[model samples]
Each structure stands twice: as structure tokens, then as C-alpha cells.
Target: MKKTIAGIEIPDGVMAQAATAQIRGTESELIFHHSLRAFLFGALIGYRESLTFDAELLYVAAMFHNVGLNVKYHRSPYRFEVDSANAARDFLRRHVVIDRLIDEVWTAIALHTTPGIPEHMSPLVALISAGVQMDVRGARYDDFTAQQCDEIVQAYPRESGFKRKIIEAYARGMEHRPETTFGTVNADVLDRWDPNYRRLNFCGLVLGSDWPN
Candidate 1:
């Protein structure tokens, strides 16, 4: 059941799996749509930039990148990113995927939220971050043409109130584990939804460090 969305091909193997269906079934409609958009946008970027990558790996990474936000994973002590990575690893292992490729996918999902680092890593990891950024914040919105954007959104429409919905999702996912949001965009959600939440100050930490100069 390979299908093309906005000119990007999603392989049948990736789409046919039970785990993929579980993701679609468990995740909210907004999250599921966002995941599809991430893969399409990532593939488009790779094509535009003439970058080579493993499409299946990138697809798997994009699809399962946010599973930690689901309620089933809320109790895990690890950060949402790590939980998502672990879920992807377990899914891949069940299918007998090679360890090396599983490791690559795990890295892509785990580091997708971190800034500055994934862009310099392997293509699978770099594209996952790139796609997430483009979808979430329009970080590279200009890289895609108007038609491309329109088509992608049409295939996986961002329903009305998407901004608020996604923010709520983020808040719910990280609220119980505020410590994990300290250095990432997840912090913004906590700051808004949890009034008592205080953001960490990198400058203050730097100044407070013991230095023997």
C-alpha cells in the first residue's frame, strides 16, 4: 500500500505495519496529521537540497517521533523524546529490523527536539529535526514553494485551532515531568499552562558555576 503524498512516496512496508496503525489509532488526529506532514516536508526538503537519505527510516522516525505524548507513555520517567525513541526501537525490533538502522531511527527521534545538533548528524536524524522544525515553527518555511505547502496541508490538513490543540497536547505530555522540559520548546508549554513553572536561566547558571580563574 505505498502511496505518494505531496509527491513524497511512503513505502508500503512502513505503512503496513501494526505498530504504524497503533500510532495512528492512539495519537490524536492533530498529532497524526502533523506526523504525516513532517515526513512529506522532510522528503521535499531532501529532494530540494539534493540530499541522499533512507526514506523508510526517515518515515518511521517522523511517524513515531511524538508517540511519547500519548497517555500510554506518560508514566515513563524518561523525557518524552526518549520515550518516543524507545517506542520506535521496540517497534523496529519486533519487525526484525537491523540494529544499526534501529539505532539511527532512535537517534533521529531522540534528538528531534534538540536544537543545533541534529542538523549536523546523519541524514535521517537531520531531516527528522528539519521536518519537525518546519512543521512546528515554520523554521524553514520559505524553502518550500507555495504550491508545495498548499498540497502538503491539503493532504494532511491542519484543522482549525491547531495551534492551541498542539500546545495543549504538549502541556499534557510534559506536565507530569516538568524537569524534562527545562532546555527545550516543551518548556514554553509548561510556562503557559503551569503558572508555578519557572524557566531555567542559562546565563545565571553560567555565572553561578565555580570558576578558579
Candidate 2:
């Protein structure tokens, strides 16, 4: 059964997939709820803005966007975004999804954490990032109506202490592969959780490099 949230229809087929089940099974309840909220908030934004996008693609992208935080992918050497992107790609391939659509979903997951760039990409890519920002940082929280927010949250409650849990999950995921966190927001998690963790300074790197004048 499909459901409409904020005037956006979430197809049943997308939600009933085995891959989607894997996400629900593997990710913490907090992360799973956050993912659903991201999609709902994204759809709400798209509806309000009248942005044309593939709803199913956005749904899948949002669902798997944080799968890298799951323990199964903790050891992955790449950034969590890349890991999640790969997982989504693999899942779509299993369903014999077309290459063009798979590429869009992959880009959406891969670049969801990236700033500025995704806004210039396809609607799916842009919407995933927007949804993530809304849920994670409340980037555009004020733009959403109180009633809309209430309904969305009521459907998928953000349990108490969600902020701390999400931060810890991010820290643990990056701690397993700290190197990947060097240049991203994941670094902030490491900085907060691991005092000894030092972020790479691009300016310092450039200055320290040998140069001939």
C-alpha cells in the first residue's frame, strides 16, 4: 500500500524490496527513522517548490543514503558516502534496474553529504542532499509548516536522544576508517569523539609543500 506524505506519493514497491528490508534490519532504529524522515521531508520540499523529480529514485536514494553507518560496512576503507553509494548501486543492480537510473541514485547517495555541488546536479541528487540537511542540521526547518513537521515526525518519531545517537554512530563509523574523514563533516565527529584526532589542513599542506620561485 502506497502512502502520500505532504502531497508526495511513496510507492509501495520501493518500500517492500528486500534491499530496503536489509537497511531496516541492519541500521539502528534511529538511523532508519531518520532515513524515512529524510525522504518525507524531501518529498515535502519538492511538493512545496514544485520541483520535478523522480519520486521513486529519491525514495531509494534517501533509504540507502546512510547504510554505510551500519556495522556491516564499518571496515570499508572509503568514505561512508561512497560506501553507501556502492551499496545502493549493488542493490539496484540486483533488481535489474537500468543503468541511467542507477547512476542517478548512486550520485544522490554519493553526494548527499557534499555541499554546493549537489544543488547543481540532477533533482534526485539535489533533493537527497536537501532532505539530509533538513533532518540532520535543520537547514531549512523554518520553511516547513508546523503542521507538516508535526505530521511527518508523528509518523516516524525522532526518539529521545536521537542527536547523541546519530553523532555516536557517525563517530564510530569514521573512527573505524579515520583517514576517510579527513576532509568531510565526518571529521567533526572524530574531532568531538577522539581528542587526538587531527583534521588535515589544506592551507598548511600547500604552504609546507616545496616550491621554487
Candidate 3:
């Protein structure tokens, strides 16, 4: 159940499972459940500040952040921390770009559940993780008026249905493979949806990737 998004191939079923686990349970959210959101937040930051970074890492991080949630909940709240870190380490070990930071990436995944544990990866990871925290806590932007925050919250449900569909597609083995090697399906699909649906969508296109018009 794999699909390529923005040149990075993802296992959609695993993520879907994570999301289902998150919605039905309560102990801690699965890393995979919120991955797209994290990636979107990271992309937003990247676009606004002109930061240069690898979209692959952002996508990977988002896709697998809560992998530990696949397991049933335990009495201890921190159990998923190590589980997620190990899963992320194993997953990222296959990639060359993030190979050097495998240890750091694991640390980020493990510590992401633990607030106050500073992020060990690059600043981009930190920023994106923060955005994720904001989302989980339902925090509103300090700068935005109360009304604006209300509007955003009302218009966009906290849950992400597009990601669910994407994951379902992946589970069904529906993939978007480009005939040309030059373009990524994620980037292409996102580009088409950006102008029309950017406001309502929280896929986090602006987080750490460029959205070319």
C-alpha cells in the first residue's frame, strides 16, 4: 500500500491505521495520524520565510511521526515515545538524505511526545513539530484576532479527511505515479488544489515546501 507524493513514496495503509487508532482512542495520538498536518505546517513555514530544505524529510516526518500509535494503548503515557522513535529510525534508515540524522530523527520522534524535550533535529523539525503541537492543543494564533481564529477553526475541522482519503487510496493500492520522472505527484496535486482550496485545507502546503504557481 505505497504511494508517491512529491517524489517521496509513502505507505498509506500504515498512516490510515494510525489515524483510525487516534480517533477511537485517547491515551496519545499516533505519529502517522498527524504526519500530513505536520508536513503542511512545516511547508507553510518554509514558504513564508524562504527557508531551503528537503521536502522528502518533511513528508517522511509527517507520514511517520506517530507510528507507535499502531499498537494498543498502555497504562503508561510515554510508551509510544520509544516505539515511534524506533519505527522512524527503521523507516528513515532506507533513505540517504536523512541517514546521517537517523539518531537525531529518532530522538525527535521519541521526544516529540514529551514537551520540554527540545528537538534534536534541524530547526525545521522543531518549527513543524511546534505547529503540530499547536494543532493538537487547538491553540490559536496569538496575532490573529479571536474572530479570525474562530473562523479558521469553524471552517476547517481539526480532523483531516483528505489525508484519510489519500491513505485509503494507498491501502487500496491506488497510486499516483507520474509518467515523467521530473515531477512529483504530491507537488502536482497540491499545486492544482492550492489556489482553490488553500484556505480550507490543512495539508500544510506552506510548511516546508515551495508551492509553485
TM-scores, all candidates, are 0.91, 0.93, 0.47
Candidate 1 residues 14-125, lDDT tens each?
A: 4435655877888988998999899888888888888989887788888899999888877778889999999899988988889999999999999998999999998889
lDDT of model 1, residue 37: 91
Clash number by candidate, in order: 0, 0, 16
Error at 171, model 2, angstroms? 0.8
List lDDT for all candidates, in order.
Answer: 0.86, 0.84, 0.46
Name the lDDT of candidate 2. Answer: 0.84
- Please write out the lDDT profile of model 2 over residues 24-99, one tens digit for every residue: 8788888888988999888787878788987777888888998887777778899999999998999889888999
lDDT (Cα) of model 1: 0.86
As a whole number from 0 to 100, the lDDT of residue 170 in candidate 2 is 85
The sequence of per-residue lDDT tens digits that candidate 3 reaches over residues 1-213 is: 654333223334543444334433532233334555455554555555566655555555555565544534222243444555676666666444346667656655555545554444565556556546654543334533455345334433445554455433222221122111112222343344335322223355456468664
- Backbone clash tally for model 3? 16
Model 2 weakest 10-residue run by lDDT: 7-16
Clashing pairs in 1: none
* Pairs of residues at least 3 apart in sequence or in different chains that clash in candidate 2: none
Q: Model 1: runs farther than 4 Å from truth?
A: 14-16, 202-213
For model 1, how big is the CA root-mean-square deviation? 2.2
Highest lDDT, which number?
Answer: 1
